[model samples]
Structure formats: C-alpha cells, structure tokens
Target: MASGLFHLAVFAVDGGPWEGPVSWRKAVTFGLSFGLTLITIAWVSSFVALGDRARNVLLGVFAADCVLEVALITVQAWRRVPSHFNMETALDTTISRMLAVGGGVLIVVLVTLTVAAFRDGAPGAAPDVALSMRLAVRAGFVALCGALLSGAAMIARGVAEVQTGHQQAAYHVAGALKPAHAVTMHAILVLPALAWLLTFTRFSEARRVRVVAVVSAAYGAAAVVVIGVSAIRFATA
Candidate 1:
C-alpha cells in the first residue's frame, strides 16, 4: 500500500499539462494532501514533553497542517470539478471525503482532551493522574512517529523514481538506501510503543513517575535510533 502511494507521488510530481487526461492541480493536491497528512502524525509522535502545555502545542501544529492540506485539496476539486458522470472520479471524491472525515474525528478527540487539560490544569494530585498523563503522551508520540515514517518513506521513493527515471524507479528502490531500510525505519515505531504499553498495562490510575518516565524515554530513544540512521545518510549526501 505504502510503496504504491510513493510511486503515485512520483508520477504526479513529474506530470503536468503535457500528460494528457491528467490534472496538474490534482497531482499537486494529491502530493501535498498526503504529505501533510504524514507530517501531522509525526509532529505529535516526536513530542516528548509530558506537560499539558506541550501536548496542546503539538496538537495545534498538527491541526494547522491538516487545514492547509485540506484547503489545497478543496482548491483542486474546485478547479477540476468532479465528474458526476464518471465512476472513477466519483470514487476519488469518495476517498477524499473519507480523509476529511477522518481528520475531523481526530480534531474532536484533540479538542476534547485539550479543553479538559485547560480546565484541569494543575500538577498531578495522585499517582493515577500522573499515569494517565504519561499514557496520553506516549500514545500521541507513537502516532506522530508513524505519520513521519510514512512521509519519509514516500519521499525516499519519490527520490528513487527521479534517479531511475520513470519505469525503473517505479519498480526498484531509489537513491541512498534499499527498500528494506525504509521498511525497517517505519516498522520500528512498534518497538518503543510496545515498551510503553508494557510499563502501564491495565494498572490503576495510581502510577509511578519513574516507571512512566523510563518507558517514555525508551520509546523516544527507539524513535531516535531510526531517525539517526536516516540522518547519517542525509548528512553524507
């Protein structure tokens, strides 16, 4: 699923008016729409701050990016105008609508929690409160990581396509690393996330700060390890 999306981006990036039956606006919309979608996920995942204020800041960033992506998609739809007469175009419209609906769901959850934090803003009154805070933080963090990994993987495939030219890039791994490297980086999000789960599993709200801290730190480190390797290649390049 991911690899297909990556190549689709490449197809759109290099496409334009010259490509008969293809809308330049649609191509750009597709790339930016999906691109921002991935970043929204990453920004939240990487935020290590457990404080209420920190979570709010991350949520704000994600929301803003999502709005930008949606606006672009709307403009594209306006210009191209969906074909009521065509089955495929209707499918595209349906899929895009689904994406927006999903975004709305995230916003609702985000706002609910954010509002609660504002009303309940105070230092932990009990161990359970502290535990709940850490759990929310870790869950958000993992989600952000997944979003980023997907975006990077997509970008890397785009690069590979550019290097290999159309057909070759479509089928083979591109640029600095093999396809497996990209897969590994993305799949690693599960590791630290599992650690976090183990630390807080079904326990009552009364939680130990030290244990939560240890788990979150481990999760952060796991994310860093994947990022660090990707960074090394970028720096050398």
Candidate 2:
C-alpha cells in the first residue's frame, strides 16, 4: 500500500512548475492534497486528546483516509465518463472535487473523534464507551478504503509523470515535481516492507532477514512518524 502511495505521489513530479495542462493540474492537485493532508495530521497530533486507541491505530486511520479519498475520486470518474468524456477540464475538476471530499472526510473524522476523545477522557461523567467504539470502527473502515484507493491513484499518476518527465526533459526540472520523484524513491523501501509483511520468505542467510527487518522497521517507523506529525497538525488546526 505504501509502495503504491509513494509512486502515486511522485509519478508526474518531473514536470516543472510551467508544464502543460496535465502537469499543471497535477501540480496543483498534489500541492493542495499533500499540503492539506500534512496540515491535518499536524493539527491532530498537536491538539487531539489522543489516547491509546488513537496512538495505536496508525494503520487503521491511514486506511480510512485512503478509502475516503478513493471513493470520492471514483465517484467523480463515474460522473465524468459520459458527458465530460472529451473535456479534460471537466475531468480535472472531477478529480479535484473527489480529493476535496476526501480531505473533508479526513478532517471531519479526525476532528470529531479527537474531540470526542477529549470529552470522554476528561473529568466528567463516565465516557461514552459504546459511542467511541462505533466511531473508531467507522474511522477504521474509512481509512482502509481511503488508503487503498488513494494509493492506486497516486501510483498511476506517478508512473505517468515519470514517463512524461523523462520525455520532456532529462532531470532538468525535478524540483517542481519533487513530490513525484520522492514518492518513487519511497516505493523502493515501501514495497519491500509490504513484501515483508504480506509474503513469507525462505532465507538461507539469517543476516539478510535481519537486515531486511531492521531497514524496513526503520523506514516504516520514520514514515509513520511523519504521518503522525501530520495527524497532530490536523487535530490542532
């Protein structure tokens, strides 16, 4: 999943700030998408009354975000297929709208849950345990779908962007498109982590396994920390 997300974020990153419509659109889309996401995460971390549940639910929360975003984008795609088949602008708008909805969902879920957490844990009557459970469940489902769909979108974009970037200019304008490039590199590590988690390996060399374990944990932890920071930001904001 992380591999897919990394590719998604980086695919078209080779384009400079002044590329064609697709490139320009991608830049704007990613700028707002990624920027706002980071902000949300930061806020949540800073202000949310995160408890053991929130602190330990990293994978679940991320999954919810991915699900929400992907569902929105898919809806937009379904809408644009007929009338706006030939209209690139319409298609772009659809994608943007989907992303916006996804962002909105993230904000809502994080903020609401965090707020509830504050209320539940604060000095008051017994916290609404049942309600909290329901919310957490809902959040997890949203995160799962959101992560999968958004990851796919990002992977497709990354592949396209990288190809286009190579054709447009050889390492000339990797700055403006840095996000794509960064995600592509990130895929290398993330894919390995997924493999480690999802697949069984018969390794003759114990050292290799150890190395993989160490490196993957380090990389994954670092990425989670970054995401955690973003979550904190969202809570506060």
Candidate 3:
C-alpha cells in the first residue's frame, strides 16, 4: 500500500512520459506486491513450522530483508538509475551488490525454514490443514528456490552484459527468466490456497492429499517447462 502510493506520488510529480531505467513507479509497484506477498507467505508458514522461537526468528529475518531490499530498489529508482547489476557509480555498485547479497540471505533463510519444517512435524492444525501446510511449505520451498536461482542467474548475466557494453541486451536477456521466476514465486500462495479450498470439499483426507499431490506435481512440472522455455528463448533471442 505504501509503496503503491509512493509510486503514484512520484508518477504524478514527474508527469510526462519519463521512460528511464529503474522507473520509480515500477520499483514501488513491485516493492509492494512482492514484499507483501512474501511477508504474508512467511507469516502463514510460521503456523506450519514447529518451534515458536524459530518461527519468530524466521519472520523477523524475512521482514527485515523485505524492508531493506525494497528500500534499496526504491532508492535506486529515485536516483533514476538501474537497480540490478548497475555499476555506473561506486554508490550504485554498492547498492546493487547489497541487493544481491540480500537475495542470498533470503534464499538461505528460506532453505533453513524448509529444513526445519521437515525436521519438526507439521503444525497442530486439522489433519487436512496440517497436510496442506506441510506440502505447501515443501513445494513452496522448491519453487521459491527455483525463482531465487533464476534471479541469481539473471543478475550474473546482467552483470556480464554490462561489462561487455551490452546494457540493453542485459535487460532483454534477464526478462526471459522473469516469467518462470514469477510463476514459481507465487506457488507459496497458490498451493496453500488450493489445499484450503479442498478442505471445504466432501472428499476424504486421503482423497484430498492424493488430489493435492497430483496437482502439485502438475504445477511443479509447469514451472519447470516455463523455466526451460524461458531459457531456450533467452538463448535464441
């Protein structure tokens, strides 16, 4: 909400088609959407996790990372410079590097949560709920990891492109990975929601799990296909 409002404010003041790298409007839009989505998923996952201390710590880490990363991206937008793989100035390079490190931290935190989840049993919710939460976390972990890895790859490619004076190509190349990364990132919400919906159905617990397993498999496969297609397109383009 705050991000969207800030984006609108910048757009209003800077009126007139201002197409530039790291557009403030876009930065804030993504900041709010992705930030809120991540926070929400993390919060929900806490219930699925076992330990209170671990859950609290994970949420804290997630919240801090969200604020820090989005803030850096937004700052870059305000400065009218590209946020990703930008090394035009020492400061820009520092911010960009920090964001990349932040991404690494995020991946570490999520993977840790995933490991903890498997070690500790599911939450004390209903059978269906527990099952759903468990599957959601595991599946979400896989998809989110894919998203992070692809994002890291995009960053690496972008950096290489910038080095070779093909800055525009960097943007085009990185875009090819966006769809796969984005689709997988949303698995945290999609899978859980599907599970929740199944809870309302007349199916037995076993049936529901079976259905969820099939759906999860299909969903994961689709994400893989998208990733492969994106990679091929990027290479060919």
lDDT of 2 by residue, 41-61 (tens): 433332234554654464256
TM-scores vs. true structure, each candidate: 0.33, 0.28, 0.86
Could you tell me how far off, in angstroms, the CA of residue 194 lies in candidate 3 after the best superposition?
Answer: 1.5
lDDT by residue for model 1 over 1-237, one digit each (tens)? 233355356556765452222344444444554454445344333323235565566566656655554454444444554311112455655644555454455555444443433343344212243443445454444434444444445344544554454533422332333222343333224433443465557654445445555555665566567656655554454
Worst 10 residues of 2 by lDDT: 78-87
lDDT for model 2, please.
0.41
Worst 10 residues of 1 by lDDT: 171-180
Winning candidate number (lDDT) = 3
lDDT of 2 at 126: 36
- Model 3 TM-score, 2 decimals: 0.86
TM-score result, candidate 2:
0.28
Please, what is the whole-model Cα lDDT of each candidate in the order they appear? 0.44, 0.41, 0.76
- lDDT for predicted candidate 3 compared with the true structure: 0.76
Tens digits of per-residue lDDT for model 3 on 31-113? Answer: 77667667656655654645666677777887788788888888887777888878888999899899988888888877776
Any runs in candidate 1 off by more than 4 Å, and if so which?
1-130, 133-139, 142-146, 149-153, 156-160, 163-207, 234-237
